[model samples]
Target chain A: MDKTQNNKAWFLVLPVLVIVAFSAVIPLMTVVNYSVNDTFGENEFFWNGLGWFEDMIASDRMHSALGRQVLFSAIILAIEVPLGIFIALHMPKKGFWASFCLVLMALPLLIPFNVVGTIWQIFGRVDIGLLGHGLASIGVDYNYTNDALDAWITIIVMDVWHWTSLVALLCYAGLQSIPQAYYQAARIDQASRWSVFRFIELPKMSGVLLIAVLLRFMDSFMIYTEPFVVTGGGPGNSTTFLSIDLVKMAVGQFDLGPAAAFSIMYFLVILLVSWVFYTVMTTLDNAETK
Target chain B: MMRARSSAIVMTVYLLFLLIPIYWLINMSLKTNTEITSTFTLIPATLTFANYVTILTDPSWYMGYVNSLIYVVLNTLISITVALPAAYAFSRYSFMGDKHLFFWLLTNRMSPPAVFALPFFQLYSSVGLFDTHIAVALAHCLFNVPLAVWILEGFMRGVPKEIDETAYIDGYGFGRFFVRIFMPLIASGIGVAAFFCFMFSWVELLLSRTLTSVYAKSIASTMTRTVSASGMDWGVLAAAGVLTIIPGALVIYFVRNYIAKGFALGRV
Candidate 1:
């Protein structure tokens, strides 16, 4: 696993760098440029400096959207990680059943985000949708379109349904990587089931668990299309998250300066968290190697 | 005995929960538009394929699928092709700023696509690549290339250095060894990476929708426009949704085994 010191590796990486720079760096520069300028209709512009950033920071709407985004991400990570681990543990180790379960479970993940929203939207409709009609028949008031709490629950459940398989699959792979000898040793020691899970399985799954949490968190925080399709940010602004709000600003209203500033801040938060996760992942990798 | 029984129950219930909504969509797709809106029926009382017929017959509807496939395949191909060399370098060699570079690439994956939507629109427009398949394909590489590199690097690191050394001793050049021996060794990795690229590109709407208009509009955007314009044609919408799920289902069927490992190994 020890890598040789070879600067010539740059030649190999050059293609990726060129491609990513074209796609990422150029657009990113444009966002930065827009963040500092004020513009009128005919491409007229003036320097806005920190005005947009200041306004974004002071706005109550921004605060609420950030609050909702954080809560959503936290809830997603908390639920999906443990639930995924549980599902993975229960899954058949090997058989036709394992393959069947995997393929079926992965189906939700492959569906388009908007379609996922559309499916849930139709499935939760009061008139013709199954869930809504069933709930109504049972004398429960459940309308995602009209009620804020209903909207929140629908979005959360929809997300859990869509993404839990990802976590389970990752955990299942982690579990599979554990050598049979480890389980044999645990059995020889007469380890209890809880102890076996605690000592042997939990530690082994930590790496994949971290990856699952990071991915789930980032994706949930940036979620837009599904919720947009489901409620269009809802009867009010209750379901509007950061990305939804930002899209309204940047694309809908053309408030370029504020949106660009908001975007930079949004990008920074993800960058910061990912950097932390990266550091932890590397540390874990090194520990495993050692 | 008790534990095994409980595990089976748990998995059965979980699978049912996952399938019900998809089942609902399919059920809706099978029913006529009038049946879909007027009544609450678990099964289609009168089955119809008119929605599918409409999509297949109409250029606007079916071309959405074609446009999506073109860009998605193009993006996947470009991402994996470029990422292979970068992943090889990261896995095997210690280059300048390698760690920083890797982290930076990953940050793009973490970026909210909403942020890039506007700038990408203007960037592609200025270059006159707007509404073109290549524009969307290239735009997607921002995230897909980084992901492909990360996945491929994990798989590549698992291959021992001895293989490369032996190949060299046998008079195999770098390119030859890579194509013949190294690539075959990591074929599953490549498959997993390509699947991930395709899945992300296929599912993403913001960047693709932003970068392309009429000629290259994806099915996802097309579906959205349908909802907005026609006051919700539930049956046809369900049919389009069902069709969109087909390609992904096919992909998952082919790569089900690798998918778990792909997630566990990539960036972990």
Candidate 2:
């Protein structure tokens, strides 16, 4: 199917670039501009020359938020990836039941982040919320507002409930795409179920799982809405991820110069890590295809 | 056989863990504030629809739903319209600076929404678009359009080149073929993309909250003011949260199959 004529499909792409540039690129440039300069309001601006960047990098507030962000992303990947794989493994391969399970697994994901936070906040209430009240009745002193450990548990549990389904769904797709002949061959070799999964399924799931991990990492690193709603970055900033802190700087304090610099640094961290994930995953994809 | 039984147990436990919070939310919505605050009940001691009734009868609360719905729909429409052409271009053509452009679009998706909350408020207020649904809708498009383009482009590539050739040989122009044949075949993918655009825009709080103090406030934004003279209205908050789940739940239930595939498309 050699093409002798140019279709001039460039027409299709121009609208996208234009819209995205207006919506994204312009705002980003504004943020970049703010990061290096000081403004006193009413369109007055002065060059500050990396002063905000230096302040942002050295600030303990920034350091703590970065630490929390990294830890949270690591925890999310650790829990969701394996748990999703386990659930995917157990899911009925083909039947009415399989479809039913798939739909059931997907329900949590459909709920919005803020709503998820609200639900947990209510559900974890000691007086009215079920989990908190139940825990108290059962002799567990669980108060998310007062206890740092409880706060961590609540957010971590909330995230796992919301996102593990995504990983499961992705891995399920990878599993579904596997040819049945491989299973039959494994059976012929008398491979154990554990061996079959370890040797065959794991490798087959690498591509989609890479995607799952990357998406989860990126999202977890930038988590704001749910945790913000749940704790309001409370219990002494223990649960304040990088995003929430950035919001506090930009919106709460109206420190545009510092916040903008923080945001750029934040964006760069996500970009750098995502780029690494993409490179490693694509290389593996290439090797697998070859 | 033993392994199968254990796996079933594990899956059941996992499902229960995932659902219990949502269940509690629904249960609390059915209870009165008195019952909610005074005692811990596994099931509501007495069920009431007062919370739902409050949200519905009150024009202000229900207005949040209307506002969120309008902007989300608008955002979805605008994103899909822009992304369809863009995604097709990326998928079909090796244009100048395609890789760089694609990455640039992705950077939009990756940037934190919180970072833009203040600027968006200032920018929109200066332009007199503040407190309008259009403002929130347009702000959402910043990220939503990039996401829609990436996902749609992935699904579009899976469509065979043979279809394009057939349309071309039949003397069907690119526009006609795209509308008549290509769109229908990728209906599921488009549905998936539209659903995502709707979901993101629907749940988004920061910009929606900052940009609209009154008119375009989303239900998520409304949840912020759930505290009243009577203290935080757990019953009302729970009720609002449950209501917020309905739109996305209904949409996902209908497109359950596509949701899985669409996620794979977006991420990859």
Candidate 3:
């Protein structure tokens, strides 16, 4: 896989670079510009320096949103990874059943994020929705619109339902790549099922597992639409994560300066975490190959 | 035998849990609004296609679907076309800043769409591309191009360098070899990349909604407006939601096997 030295490769990458730069760099610069300047109506501006950053640092609102976001992502990763792995392990490896399982499991993933939110929103309603009415009929009180705990549970479950299939599919693919000779060797050694999983399967699946973790972490952290539709970050600001809060500040209220600063910091955190994941994964890949 | 039986039972339960909500949505879509609200029936008391009729017959409703498809298709085509060469470069030759460039592309993929929402709104409007299909398609490239490169690079790397050498020995130029030989070899990779691009573009709302208002309004945003306006038409909303799932379902059906292979190999 070692590549040759060819500076002309730059030409190959130019088209992507131009498109991404237009889409990413220009807007990013605007955010930076807004972060440093205060503006009133008619696009009139004043120097704000680090005022917005200072205010963001001192604000409890941003802190709470960050806290909620971290907790949500952690919970999602903890649940989805193991549950998805379990589902993948149990899945039929070949034939019609495998295709059937894949198609059905992948359905949630293909649905629009807002539709997912709407489905859960109605499904969890007390009067008309099935889950809500069923819970009430069974003498269990549940209302996502009112109770913070119920709202949190519903969002978590909704996320799990929507995304667990992705993890399962990735792991299933990882499992499929293992050669049959490996299993034959384990059988010849009379290896226990646990040992077989521990020795043969886990290491083989690590590459895909890392990819799954990274993807799930990034996506869950940036989640906006589904939760926005379902809870509107509501029942009190309890469900308002970083993205929701940022949108409220930037678009809803037009606090451009603070929102810009907040966004820079938010983007940095994701970048740092993703960089760390990327480094670790690449290191593992290199080590495995060596 | 016992273990296999338990595995089957567990999978059955898991599948049911996955399916019930989708089933509920479909059930609601088939029922009239009155039936949907008044009764707790597992099956529709009386099936009605009025909701579907409403969507199909209305320009505002059905155009949302058309708008989404146009941009998604455009974005996928542009992303893959641009990414193929970039991916080839990364796979075959390590140029100056190659590693840094690769990582930087990924950082864009990691960048939160919310951060860029306001700036993109202004940027597009200033250029007079706002509310246009091309604007959304271009804006989505920030993420999709990097991803397409990442996925395509993985597939390209899997193809031995010897092919390029052999093609050269056969006096085939880079363009000819790429189109005639390399493309067919990595066709599945392209399919997988296109599928991922389409999925992300299809599901994304905030940016697409922010960037386009009328001429290129997406179905997701249209659904949101429906929920907010006056009395909520639960039946129609459910029906709209059901329709939104159709395109993605069709895509998944076609690429079921490639999807898993793509994920496992493509650094997704």
Best of the candidates, DockQ: 1
Fraction of native contacts in model 2? 0.60
lDDT of 2 by residue, A78-123 (tens): 9989999989888877777777787778887777678888888887
Better of 2 and 3 by lDDT: 3
Q: How does each model score on lDDT?
A: 0.93, 0.84, 0.93
Model 1 interface Cα RMSD in Å: 1.1
Model 3 agreement with the true structure over A159-264: per-residue lDDT tens digits: 9999999999999999998999999999999999999999998888899999999999999999999999999999899999999999999999999999999999
Poorest 10 consecutive residues by lDDT, candidate 2 chain A = A1-10
Q: After superposition, how far is residue B4 of candidate 2 from its true place, in Å?
A: 3.6
Once model 3 is optimally superposed onto the true structure by TM-score, how far is the C-alpha of residue A135 displaced, in angstroms?
Answer: 0.8
Model 2 reaches an interface RMSD of 2.5
lDDT value for candidate 1? 0.93
TM-score of chain B of 1: 0.98
User: Which scores greater on lDDT, model 1 or model 2?
Assistant: 1
Compose the digit string of candidate 1's lDDT tens values, residues B64-107. Answer: 99999999999999999999999999999998999999999999
lDDT of 1 at B66: 99
Please report how far candidate 3 places residue B24 from its true position, in Å. Answer: 0.5
Deviation in Å, model 1, residue A16 alpha carbon: 0.6
Collision count for each candidate, in order = 0, 0, 0
The residue pairs that clash in candidate 3, if any, are none
